[model samples]
Structure formats: C-alpha cells, structure tokens
Target: MLLKEIKDIFYKELGDIYPKEEVNSFFYACIEHYLKLERFILAIQPGLTLTKEEEQPLFEALSQLKLEKPLQYILGTAHFMDLELSVNENVLIPRPETEELVQWILADCQEKKQFKLDAERSRSVISTPLNDRSLQILDIGTGSGCIAIALAKHLPNAKVFALDVSEKALKVAQKNAESNKVDVTLLKHDILDPELDPGLDFDIIVSNPPYVRELEKEEIKKNVKDFEPSTALFVSDEDPLLFYKAIMDFSKRHLKENGRLYFEINQYLGKETEALFKAHNFSEIELRKDIFGNDRMLKAIKK
Candidate 1:
C-alpha cells in the first residue's frame, strides 16, 4: 500500500484516543525514523514503498501505538541532550520535564564555580570551581540511566555515579550507559538505609524519585499506570514525601561540603519539599517551574 493510504488507516485507528493532528504527527515521525525521509520528502515521494518485512514492523508498531504504548518505547530509543538512549519496559521513559531538569542542572553548574566543603555534614554545595578534576556528581533513583549518562556525556570532566535500589532498573541503566558510550557507576542502593557507603561525596546531587502517591494512582492515565514500572512511580499515601526525606538524609551523610542538590519533585509537594530542606538546615533553596508553570524542580545548598 502507498504511504498516504497507510496514514489514512493510521488516523482512523488512533483518532479515538489521540487527536487527529497528533496521530498524524506521530505517524510522520515514526515513518521518518524508519525510512530516513523528511516529511516533505516523504510527501513528495509517495511511490517509495516498504518491503514486506519492514511493513510488518511498521504495522506492528502502529498496532501497539493504538494500544497506547509510548512511541519512545515502541522505537526503543529516545533523544536526550546530545545522546540517544535505549528505552524499554524495564525503565521509566524519559519525559520532557526530566529533560528540563537536566538542562537546569547543567545551567546551574555553569552559574557556580567553587563548592564549599562541609566536612562536618559530609556534603558540599556547588560554588566556583578551582579545576576540572574536582567535579563530582551523583544521580539517585536513576531508572534508564538517562540523567547520569547525559551528565557524563555533557560534562566530560565530572566523575559520575548513578544509584537505584531496583536491580532491574540498574540493568536498564547499565545498558543505557553502554548504549550512550559513557561510563557510569551503577549501584544497587536504597537511600533510606543507614548503611550507605560513607566515602562518597558529591559536589552536585540530582534525583527524580517515586513521589506519586498510592492514592493518586487512580488519577494517572491508563497508559502510564498500566505499562510503566510501578515501583518507580509510587509512594505510600501516608508518606508521599518518603523519597525526598530519605534522599535528604542520604545527602546529609554522602554529600560534600557546600554540595548543591537538585530534585525533580511532585508538583503538589513543592512547598513541603522546600520546608523539609529548610528543616534540615539547607539554605539557598529555590523552586522553579517547568513550561507548564507547575513547580517541578527544587535546588538547595547544604548550610
């Protein structure tokens, strides 16, 4: 069948759940990836055809999309910063909001030079830097290793490490590091435990942890609650800030003096998160909104 003919059926299949315009956009984007053709070129060359084998995969992906599987998972790869990462059911799909978090951290690093070392608390807040060798960073609850790999790729001088409690998530993270051709130390670690390795000290620490409450699960869209890893998506209703509090405790012991910490937080808990940090004596706390004007990222300096 011709490309135009296929797209007509595509909209018909996905239009009920997705907007007509969005389905068309996804259709063109998928075709462009598979055929290596631009939208205009694909439009001009209607005669270009897929072989039977290729056609099978295309339709298979289309069918999956109709079922609401994310396109990034269907494609098995996603673009983040300057790197392309392999993605699958084993990990949480990278979202644009997380991409914004990455950008904010990068920009924040640029804004600060040296970090003060807090030996008493074993944490450091980012400040002006003296040299490249001193740069250190850690990513907590790294699902697909997106944040760690991206940081390693972008900041070549920084020593990067990623920690996740789930072994399955760590596997995906390891694969992402390999796929991106960057080295990251992936640790199987639960931040709440007191036995955390004591030697690690980071100038900058970032996390996108499970903050969605169990009570809120009913509110999430069907596609997400059904397919993504649940352990990476949920927190108990009684303790929705569990991860944030635990992470702060972990940072108290593991972070370098004057270390700057960043978190991709639950929008509903922005005020609570800032208060928790302040209660821990963290100063210079700042909350920033994403493009949607929702409180999404928080940063603080250890005092």
Candidate 2:
C-alpha cells in the first residue's frame, strides 16, 4: 500500500482516540521505528510502498493504539533525558515529570560542586580538587533505571546504585543501564520489607516511589491503569505515605551527614511529604513544582 494510504488510516482510526496531532506524530514515530524512515519521508516520497513484513507490524501497532495501549510500550522504547530506553510491561514508561525531577537533581549537584570549587579558590586551598571528591547516589525503587542512569551519565564523579523490589523491574533497569553505557549497581531490595535496611551510606538518596493511593486509581488513565504494573504505581489508601516514611527512616540510617534526599512526590501531598521529612529531623526541606506547576518534587537534607 502507498505511504499516504497508511497515514490516512492512522488519522481515520486513531483521531477519535487520540488528538489529531498526536496521531500524526505517532504515525511518523512508528514509521521511523519499524520502517527505518525519517518522520517526513513518507510525505516527501508520496509514492513509497511498504512490503508485507513492514505493513504487518505497523498495522498491529495501530490496533494496539486504538485500544489505548501506550505508544511507548507498543514501540518498546521511551525517550528520557535524551536517551532512548527499552520499556515493556515489566517497567513503567518514563514520564516528562520524572525527567524534570532528574534535571532538578542535576542542577543542584552541579551548582553545589561549583560552589565548593569557588570556596576553595577563595580560601587558597588548592590541595583539594573537585575530581578528588566523589559523590555517591542511591535510587530507591528505580522502575526503569531512568533516574539512576541519568545521574551516572551527568555526574561523572558520582557512583550510582539502584534498588528495586521486583526482579523483573530490576532486569529491565539493568538493560537500560547497559544501553545508556553508565555504571549503575542494581540491587534486589524491597523498601517495605522490615528486615531489610539500607546499611550503606550515600551522599544523595532519591526515589520516585509508589505513591498512588488505591483511591486515586480511578483518576489514572486506562492506558496506565490497565497496562502498567500496579506494584510499581500503588500504595494502600489506608497508608498512602508508606514508602515515603520507609525511605525517610532508611535515609536517617544510611544518608551521610548533610547528605541530600530527593523524591518525586504526588502533587496532592506536597505539604504532607515535607512534614514527614521534618518529623524525621531532616532540615532544609523544599517542595517544588514540576513544569506543569504541580508540586511534584521534594528535596531535604539530613543534618
């Protein structure tokens, strides 16, 4: 069939399910992934024809999209921090808000390094250099290793580690780490397990833990609610702060003096999350919003 023919079918079938522009974008993205063509190649070469093998997979992906399956999952990849990551039902699709979370951490870490350098230069203490001082970071419940791998890539002086309860999730994260070409130590850890304590020290501890309460499931989209792994997305309604509390307690035990803690929190519980840090004697707490102006990121210092 002609390239324009498939494009027309994409618009006709998916326009109602997705916005017109989104359908157009998805059509192009699928073509790029499956057919090895650039985004506008079809438009430029209007007479392009797809062989049977190429048409089969593209049509299958379109059918999945009509059922509201996420395009990222159907494509088996998601872009995060300018890196293409493999994603499947085993791991949650990386979101833009999580990308914002990563940017915040990177900015703070880089700024802190600069300030330290400036202070040394002012004091004429040339003996210690930035490269000599290494940072250690631990990411809890790293779904697809997005945060940990991004940190490792950007923070050249940092040693990064990731912990996840599900071995399946960790397997996916491990592939992402290798694909990103960043060194990240993956550990099988259940943060909620009372017997397991993070005994190691870290300069930075971060998490985008399971914060969605059961009551909030109704608010989630069908694509996320039905297709994504529930264990990575939910907490009991009766104890919505379960993971935060555990991480805070764990931070107290494991975070080095003045070490920072970061979380990508639920927008509705910004104050409550901050208060949890305060109750645990954590200081310098700040709750910040995402690009959409929702309170989605929090940072605290263990003093």
Candidate 3:
C-alpha cells in the first residue's frame, strides 16, 4: 500500500483518540521506526509504497494505540535528557517534568565547587588532588534510573546510586545505565519500610517518588492510568505524603551535614511537602516550579 494511504488511515483511526498534532507526530515516528525513513522523505516521495511485510507491525502498533497503550511502551524505548532508554510495562516512561527536575539538580550542583576527591581513585581529600570531588548522590525510587543516569552523565565528579522497591524496575534501570555509559549503583531498597536502612552518607539525596494521590487518578490520562505502573505513581489519598515522610526520615540518617535533599512533589501539596522538610529540621528549603509554573520541585538542606 502507498505510504500516504496508510498514513491517512492511521490518522483517521487515531484522531479521535489523540490531538491532531500528536497523531501527526506519532505517524512520523512510526514511519521512522518501522521503515527507517526520515519524516521529510514521506513528504517528498509522494508515491512511496510499503510492502505487506513492512506494513504488518504498523497496523499492529495502531491496534495497540487504539487501546490507549503508550507509544513509548509500543516502541520499547523512551528518550530522556536526549538519552534513549529501554522501557516497558515494568517501568514508568520518563516525563518532561522529571527532566526539569534533573535540570534543577544539575544547575544547583554546577554552581558550587567543593573540595572533592579526584576521579582516578576513591581517596581522601588530602591524599587526592583537590578537584571536583565526586559528590555522592542517591536517587530514591528510581523506577527507570533516568534521574540517576542523567546526573552521572552531567556531574562528572559524582557517584550516583539509585534505590527502588521493585526488582523488575531495577532491571530496566540497570539496562538504561549501561546504555547511557554511566556508572550508577542500583539497589533494591524499599524506602517506605519502617526499618529501611539509611545506608551510606550522600552529598545529595533526590527522589521523584510516588506522590500522586489516589484521588487524583481520575485526573490522569488514560494512557498513564491504564499503562503505567501504579506502584511508581500513586500514594494513599488518606496519607498522600507517605513517600516524602519516609524519604525525610531516611535523609535524617543518611544525608551528610549540610547535604541537600530534593524532591519532585505533587503540585497540590507543595506547601505541605515544604512543611515536612521544615518539620524534619531541614533548612534553606526552596520550592520551585516547572515550565508550566506548577509547584513541582523542592530542595532543602540538612543543617
């Protein structure tokens, strides 16, 4: 069948399901992934045709889309911070809001130069030449290791570690670390556990944990609600601050003196999340907004 004909059918079938621009973008992505052709090629080659074999998966993908399955899951990959990451049902697809969170962390770290150890060896400050010390960063509830891997890539003098409750999510996160060519330690730790060990001290502890209140599920998109892992997305409405509380408790024991703690919080509870940090005796607390101006990120210091 001709490429234009199939493209027309794709739009007709999905236009009701998604916005016009999104459907158009997805159509091009599908062509590029399946046919190995650039989007402009479709425009230039008006008579472009697809063989029956080549069209098979395109139709299959369309069927999945009709079911509201996320395109990232259908493609088996997602791009975060311009790094292509392998994703599946076991992991939540990385989002732009989280990317903003990463940018915030990177900006803050870059603004300061500390008496850190050299990258060549893990030696003391005296023994190793004073360079950008490898700051220790721990990402709690790292579903796909996006934040951890991005930090390792951007912060050359930082050792990044990630913790998650799900072993399956850790597997995906590990693959992403390898793909990104960054060294990130992955650990299976349930931060919510009352007896959870607050392991080694860290210069920074950041988490984009399960902050979505259960009552807010209805506000989520069908794609996210139907496809993404609920464990990585939600908290009990009665106790919406569950993960933030646990992380605060963990930071108390694990964060170094004057160390920083960061969180991507629910917009509705920004003041409440900030209050938790204050209650925990965290100083220099700052609440910031994302591109949309929603209260989306929080930063605090262990004083």
* Backbone clash count, each prediction separately: 19, 0, 2
Compute the lDDT for candidate 2: 0.89
Instruction: State candidate 3's TM-score.
Output: 0.93
> 123-234 in candidate 2: lDDT tens per residue?
9656455441378899999989999998888885688999998898999999999998989999898887766765679989999998998999999999999999998899
Q: What residue pairs are clashing in model 2?
A: none
lDDT of 2 at 206: 93
Best by TM-score: 2
| Candidate 3 regions with alpha-carbon error over 4 angstroms | 114-132
Q: Which 10 consecutive residues of model 3 have the lowest summed lDDT?
A: 112-121
Candidate 3, 89-198: lDDT as tens digits = 99899999999999988877755533332333456445434223558999999988999999988886788899999999999999999988999999898998878875
Note the Cα lDDT for every prediction shown.
0.84, 0.89, 0.88
State TM-scores per candidate.
Answer: 0.90, 0.96, 0.93
Runs in model 2 with CA error above 4 Å?
Answer: 124-133
Least lDDT summed over 10 consecutive residues: which range in candidate 2?
Answer: 124-133
